[model samples]
Target: MGCGTSRPRLDDSDCNPATGSTRKSAAPITNITQSYQRARCSNTNPQRSRAIGRGGDAKPPSYEREDPRRPGQAVLNILKGGLALKREGTVNAFESCKHKRILVLIDDNHKMDRITKRAICSLASFILLIGHGYQCDMEFRWPGYNNNDSPKLGTAGSEMAKALQKLMDTKTWEDACEMIDANDKLQEVGLKTWVENQLKWKPSNDQFQFAEQYRHHLPGEAIRVANLKGNDTDEDLHRKLRVEARSIMAKHIAGWAANDIDRTHLMKLDTEARKKSERDQKLSSNLGFEYRKAMENYEREMHLGADGTPTLVILLVASPITKTEKDSIIDCQRNIMASLGTKVANGSRDAYAMQTVVFTKSMASANLKHFQDIDDAFKGHHDINDLTKVEETKFCKNGPSPELLAKIFNSNLSSIDKSELGERELYSQEILTDGKGDIQWPSHEDVMRTFRPDDGDSDSEG
Candidate 1:
């Protein structure tokens, strides 16, 4: 039959009578191939299909453009959905959301859930919005939010309060200024007002008195004395001035102690007295003993010319002896006299034959050569008796008695003994040896080496 003539009987075989050979039917084959080509073309040209629709030359539906300034519609939708879920008490929207950050809106009427509050706080950063009727307030809290600790938040005011406190405590404008300047925040408070107030402030009476005392001394003098010159900066000059002012005040206090006999004045010089009094219970008693001893020494020197006074006073003018060396010499002489069966009286003469008086360099009014000649006369004698024959014709114009010479020589011997025993003790054997024989004088070092502490002689104590 012809391919289009009559319908052929349905058969599973691939043979066609029209083709006259074993082949698939052409009509069915053509229909299958056309359907596959259409499908393949549609798959490969998807953009062309999207650009054109059933209407032909049609465009895709466009979305409304988002305003750059306003929140996105998606964000608004999510917020609305979250609020609806929160009202329904389904899950806490802030906790259930996969978003790393979210805005939390709080109103006067809305009660915030604890978990929502904690989640908001735990976020790395978030915006907090508060609604007040028609108005909304927004605040941002980030990783480095410092609550009330920032200098912008009354830190300068707090520092100013502390500076005022220090001002009240120190009562000095300079000290208060220094404290205020040390704080960066307080320094922003300005110094003009502080300076004006300081100028108006009246000093206490004691402060006025101290200022008056140092009124003649210039700040330049302090700078010079402190050895702060070209090398020192302006700040160093100001610091040195303050230190020098303090030192001058201390010196004034010390002068009061030295010149005046008042106990109060002396106590002023003893800055550590209060601390010592706190630590030592017997501090007051010890001070009393020292004062009494000083008074006794003063009285003995004042009454040197009184009767029964065996002490002979010698004035040393421009003597080579220093005060310390002189004192050591005198102590050594007293010890030697004590060993010779003659005891030096503590106060008035009791049984001692003679007491030698040694004057300081300040007391000497005589010629320098006269004192030098006297020093030569008493130089080498070991025995006190031998010193009595020293000629005093050159020492004094009218030659004083040999007994006076003995007193001077004995006093001088004490110094010689101390020198021999103290620093020159090692060479004493060579230096003190006369042509006749060794004087056998004991040095202070030898005495100290042989000395032993007395184990409580309780019977003698009784």
Candidate 2:
């Protein structure tokens, strides 16, 4: 046999190369074993023939060798496929772009998922190593699954809801308390177990990472102590202080009460003070007084003359006075001027010089008699120097002619003479005059002679 030759199978009875024979032997297995040992010692391909004899498929040894570059190639293929999909446009350009964007997002998510898995695995490995009494920090980059089968996050609320519903239906306080306590304890245990399982690399079937959303925050003191070397940056410190301040502000706001008796009393006092101030302002700005002052100022500024002004701008009521009561009327005028002076300081020129005027029918009949009395009464009075003026006119009854009465009563002479002068009224009868200055008052005979009586009346009477 050659040194590098293959061993013969048990079915092939040709044991020696010098003689080839096919025969059934009692120790055929012995011959095959001897030949296999010899082939092994001679460095022949005995393993291939052995595999064939055992009904195993023969394969090249190169197939067992792992390619170190295969992972990189796979990553490249995936990237190329992604790019190809992106470049390939569809009839609906919007949907294509949207799909591409989603694909890119999915790719980024996959990368993040890989990184997260590696991080979790590293942490879990660290925990395991710590359990086995390892002291050094170890970083791992391999991915792992967390297959833990604990109750999912947020389920505690549902459980509480069920218990609360039961308590509402039954109205048992003790049972409700027990249920709450039990739920609290259950939540605490669940939290602890979940943390333990995460640290121990247990796999989870959840679609989302619960720890990602519901994180256990470390205490501020613990964080500060952990950062003994003052590694915290300025931004981090500011953020921490801001968060603390916001928390404090929130606590104060949550406990705030608007109905505090002291605060309410203070507010009432403030409101009363404001109202009093408004009232004082209103009293100070008296519209009537201000209006009078404004009118006086305007008249003084404009320098208006009596001819350009009205005889009476306003009418005021006054009692009729006799000529003997002239001093009393003058005193009243002085008082009115004083009141006008108090309301308006600059009373040099006003709509009314004396601010009041009194007129009586008897004074009008006496012409200048009552007028002189009024002037004399106010002449020496220091308060009514230029501030007062009095005037009188003829009375309607004692006028120079009946025209005065007509003007006073705003009526025709006929109507006035008939009402006041009686039967001796003017224009009582129709007068006829010719151009020769002869006038005649028609008597009843003349009027009857001018008009004939109706014939029908004359015939009916006789």
Pick the TM-score winner: 1
TM-scores of the candidates in the order shown: 0.15, 0.14
By summed lDDT, the worst window of 10 consecutive residues in model 2 runs over 100-109
Clashing pairs in 2: 146-202, 146-203, 146-204, 147-202, 147-203, 147-204, 148-203, 148-204
Cand. 1 TM to true fold? 0.15
- Give the number of the best model, judged by lDDT: 1
Candidate 2 segments whose C-alpha is farther than 4 A from its true place: 1-320, 342-350, 353-371, 379-462
Q: State each model's CA lDDT, in order.
A: 0.27, 0.26
Shift in Å, residue 258, candidate 2? 67
